[model samples]
Target: MGIFKIEGGKQLKGQIQPQGAKNEALQILCAVLLTPEKVTIHNIPDIIDVNKLIDLLGNLGVTVEKLASGSYTFQAKTVNLQYLESEAFKQDGRGLRGSIMIVGPLLARFGKGYIPKPGGDKIGRRRLDTHFEGFIKLGATFRYNREDYFYGVEATQLQGTNMLLDEASVTGTANIVMAAVLAKGTTTIYNAACEPYLQQLCNMLNRMGAKIKGIGSNLLTIEGVTSLQGTVHTMLPDMIEIGSWIGLAAMTKSELTITNVNWEYLGQIPNVFRKLGITVEKRGDDIFIPAHKNGYEIQNYIDGSVLTISDAPWPGFTPDLLSIILVVATQARGSVLIHQKMFESRLFFVDKLIDMGAKIILCDPHRAVVIGHDFKSQLKATTMTSPDIRAGVSLLIAALSAKGTSTIHNIEQIDRGYEHIDMRLKAIGAQIERV
Candidate 1:
């Protein structure tokens, strides 16, 4: 585990570039297994989860070549199917949740797929029923080994069919889409997750000769192709990271400019922050946030009701940013409710904020009511542990705004999502050290 020692009460002023989307990279990297030819991908984020996936791919006998810092060519000409049954592979596969996405491409192209139980943050129950059920709907046989705790899917030839997912799961949609792209016939998926990551995966598959429509909508139609050819794909900037920077700037009263953000793809993120009375400016493709000198205030609803910020699907505010929103609301004027509808335990981190002198009431597992201090009271720094990736960054932001130096342990959680976070913040005049 790593620790970040941060000295708060410093104003940051500079420009920072968001890294490649981590979610997009996970799906894109898995898609490389669909073709035998070389698939070149650019703008890949260098994070722990992604690196673990890359290592797993190499272990599966895919030829990986580094073209540049954030560019790679993957050729899956000779995959070691036998390796999937190995104990070492099972242990490595369970290290990250995104590793489960590899099953779809493997099942589609090779007629069989296997994965160990996937592991990720303990925020809530992230079920895999959607992914497996979608595969089963596509004429695949699903079996789970209880003793070994492994999942395997097999089909001599997958036949496409219509699937209405129980929920619009992001990874589930990506997995099903990858499987359906190489099935025998057309596949229609309603209530599909159409986030930017999924859209990029569909576009990349289309370039590889897969027939897919509905680029940025919930309804997706894909016609199975016999085979896919290699293609080059570049990922969009990380919108979550962009949102994190916005919240950090506002909390620390910093003048920060986030560069080259895909403003079009960042749906409702800026507006969510603005609802909390944060200053967000759009200068072409960049976002410039001026320092909040007099302290920011929460905006009331049109009916003069307390504002409520909740998580929803794409084009809606992301659940990942709700933690940042909660932390930022601590210094705002007036009160607001933070509702984390998707994950139950994500709001528990607010207890740490309460320890730092923030007035937050933990209503339940999924909701919290925050009464903003509005800069009249400054949070005193303390020792804390990062619960998850998003919450870790939110805590880092809180420590940046606190009065004294704070130590955050288990920052490996933060590194899993954000690439070189301490280094990036340090370049922007932040007082942070990794120990």
Candidate 2:
């Protein structure tokens, strides 16, 4: 129930290092449960969701020791899967979608997995059918009781086969890949999500004895092994945070430098932002944003018409970042239509933007038309509560550019992803306080 009070209209200027990706860290932590060896992870983000996963793992008898600020040593040498029955474990595990990932690893190693309904961003109806379908294909039986979903694999030997996912769910693909790595035969997964996070998961699993092919492609081939050993790996810097920082610098007209960004894994961030007229300068592993004075120009079609920003599967503009980019576009020069095909309710938060003097048209649950203010900063401060991770960040950006002080509650939602956001923004001259 915390709130953030921000006095707007200040330029942010500083060097900020993006933290480890929360999405990647969540699955890698669950991978520790697959083996009873010591696993050391470096550059782990100190976020709410990661800490909750650690607590859940500890409840299941995994020994998680914090070695440093962004480093941890986890040993699931004696994990008791029965902790799933405990209320504390169930509540914490139900807090995020990544918790469902533990179901696959636990079932693969221990022959049984218990999971409750997951709670995450209410962006859309995210289905767990993909996870269950993959599980059933790998010799697992699923039963749904009144409240919880139970999965049991009574087969003495799990045999891998061909799996064609119904949709390219990011976490669903990761869950199935983890389960298939310990099966008996070779597993072929088609239509898999190939995000950078998924690539990291595959690489980490390979380092631990699992053979996976097509690292950054949609089709994945996993060669099952008897067991996996422990290994130490460093996670890549967060790409979402890099994109969030870029949007923040662009909207507030700030000069900022993002350090330790993985230039090779930028995906479509550069091209997408360039469409909205944002310039990014790359110097080695660092990216610098100059003080943006003149508002950026939107890209027009070849026939001198308006263009749109839409989200697609991997190797396309990520749906996770559309909300942030939309907010940034509101402060730019021209107009663009943001099409969110993956989620039905994600674009609904734009009504709050409309309340703050932004000219936006809610075309449908999946699309919105945003007209920029052409460098005008007439947004008035308002009281609002964060809805989700990306939406919360977008609202924060709107709050930062508003004319007066704005109060946003439920900052814990924002903390689930961004690392020490208030402190980092303070270093860059933005006046934000946690109360």
Candidate No. with top TM-score? 1
TM-score of 2: 0.97
lDDT of 2 by residue, 1-435 (tens): 889999987888889999999889988888998888899999999998888888888889999999999999999889786677667776776787778899888877887777888877888899989988898898887877654644334345668999899999888999999889999999999999999989999999999999999999989999999899999989999998999999998988888899989999998997888888888989899999888888788888789788888998889988889999899989888899999998998998887888888989999998888899977656778889898999999999989988899999888889998899999889888999999
Clashes of each: 0, 0
Q: Which lDDT tens digits does candidate 1 get at residues 169-251? A: 99999999999999999999999999988999999999999999987899999999999999999999999999999999999
TM-score of each: 0.99, 0.97
Model 1 worst lDDT run, 10 consecutive residues: 343-352
Error of 1 at 336 (Å): 0.6
How many steric overlaps does candidate 1 have?
A: 0
